[model samples]
Target: MFSPTGEIVADAQRRGVGVGAFNVITVEHAEAIVTGAEAAGVAVILQISENAVRFHDGRLAPIAAAARCVAELSSVPVGLHLDHVESDELFDQAAANGFGSAMYDASKRDYEGNVAATAAAAQRGHAQGLWIESELGEVGGKDGAHAPGVRTDPGEAAAYVAATGVDALAVAVGSSHAMTTRDARLDHALIEQLREATPVPLVLHGSSGVGDDDLRKAVAAGIVKINIGTALNIAFTGAIRRELAVQTSVDPRRYLRPARDEMAATVTRALRVVTLL
Candidate 1:
């Protein structure tokens, strides 16, 4: 059944588990996430990023429709999220496009500018009955929170949430995006500190780099929503590459099936850490 992002997140919070929010680049990605969710018997989020909208030719309606259908058809609970949204127009499309929640990314702006922009975005989201999430500047390696030595302050995070009225905050402790290696160290004490200091649920971006043991520890420390992208991409792309190297047929279906299955397996394993661990 389709679930509310807030409900899933709140439930995860109450249970001391991290809710996995998997990024959906294609409908296949959404399908695989749901399959993994069902296998784990957990409610998972399917996230469509602003870049993904552009990749679908600057129209969110089609991708949104497909992802929504995938979520609606899932046997397990699933929620749709618009992730890393930088444009106000895109944020405006969240509710209209069937997204239950959105992450307004104004972290590239100056601190005050981020606050102002994110605050306005949060207001719009709240008025539309959408759960809104925001980050405190860059957190790690890529665009969606990854830079060396940059970490969110507990005081500033609390203030940002208060200033923006966002439902959740993505803070950097130690993790980089697009990391193939799963050895990124995390600051569990800082996570606990932030959890204590901030009123809303805590989110962790660029978590693909975090190892399984560390991921479990982070959730235990107080991370509610964990964003994972690179890991799924790795599984999907690697499977496709291997299939193409051996197969004579050029049909996309033949390759994509294995690719999607590989991603599903990766998702199930990752979900187990946050859920069953």
Candidate 2:
């Protein structure tokens, strides 16, 4: 029963360091995350997204509750997070489900609109004793635009946090969502500038696209939370695909066990890179 209580993020912020926030799509993913974190001796965040919730028939409570259960059972500190959420309704649902933190993404809207919506979401999240994370620039591949080159304005980001009162801010610095490759190049100077400009901790979204060395550099430059989704998915799915292709008549657990182990190793690699351990 080791919930994070924002200790990881707070510690990172206080020391100008970083923590990893990986998205959990299934029980296997949850198990892998906790396993990896304990092995590395570092705290981590387990996040569930809105699209993932939709896939489970609009019921966030069960999955969120499951994530909380995973967090509680882990040996290392964990925080259950809702990733890239857009609606006030779902935001409320996350708090009720016992999420410790969440990211409210309104980057598709105009800057002012994003501020208003994120601020409202923050207000609701804070009321429930939950932490709020908001994004600045839109991560590409969601609306089919694929604007991976967009960078968040340091000045605008500072203003956005002041307006929204978010605990963390995800800013664009050359990472795109759902990337299958780790070729993304981050703006290290921009990250340092943002750290100076904003009061809250900086989160790097679409971090699966970032290579290991660059990820460590980003963290050293003041990124406190790194959000990873596609990398673990790739590991999980690839392991399963490889296993299923080899044996058609095997039990599901036999395949899923390796899948979970592979994903846990992937998470361990990621934590090592970003946490610099």
Candidate 3:
């Protein structure tokens, strides 16, 4: 059944487990997410990122509708979320298109500006009856710029959540975006501190880099929402590459089927590891 992101997170909080939020870049991605959720018998979030919207020429309706269809057909609860959305217009579009929740990212702005913009966005989301998420202190390696280490201050993160009225908070905890290596180190102590300081559910973005043991620990430490993107893409592209290398099939479906299956397997493994189900 289709579930609201708030309800999914609340269930995770009650169960002391993390809910996997996988990024959906295509119809196949959406289908794979639902398949994996059903395979694991666990609830999952289908997230569409801002870059993915742009990839579709800013037309989010088709993919959003596709995800909603998959969600409705799934026996397990499935939620749709817009991830890392920076514009109010895009956020509104997601809500209009039936996304149950959105992460309004204003992390590039100054602290006060991020708070003000996220607060306004949160109000708009709440008015639309959508759950809102926002990040404080930009996660590292966004757009290929990896510099001095950046981590979210537990105190500031708590303050940001209190000020923004968001349903979830994504914090920078030593994970970098677009990491091909699964060696990112997370500060479990800080995760616990942030959880203790904030009332809302905690979100961990750029989670593809974190290993399975660390992910289980993060959930145990209080991260309820775990966002994954690159890992699925890796599985997809790797399958496509291998399929093409072995066969000379020109049919797109021939390769895409393997890709989708690979991605579903990855999602299933992640769900089992993160939720320990």
TM-score of each: 0.97, 0.96, 0.97
TM-score of 2: 0.96
RMSD after CA superposition, every candidate? 1.4, 1.5, 1.2
Q: Give a tens-digit lDDT track for model 1, residues 225-276.
A: 9999999999999999999999999789999999999999989999999885
By summed lDDT, the worst window of 10 consecutive residues in model 2 runs over 141-150
> Considering TM-score, where higher is better, how would the candidates rank from best to worst?
3, 1, 2
Which candidate do you rate higher for TM-score, 2 or 3? 3
Inter-residue clash pairs, candidate 1: 139-145, 139-146, 140-145, 140-146, 140-147, 141-146
lDDT of 3 by residue, 193-228 (tens): 989999999999889999999999999999999999
In order, what lDDT does every prediction score? 0.90, 0.85, 0.91
| Model 2 agreement with the true structure over 99-162: per-residue lDDT tens digits | 8888888988998899989898899888988888988986675555345446788899888889
Clashes of 2: 0
Q: Ten-residue segment with the worst summed lDDT in candidate 3? A: 141-150
Best by lDDT: 3
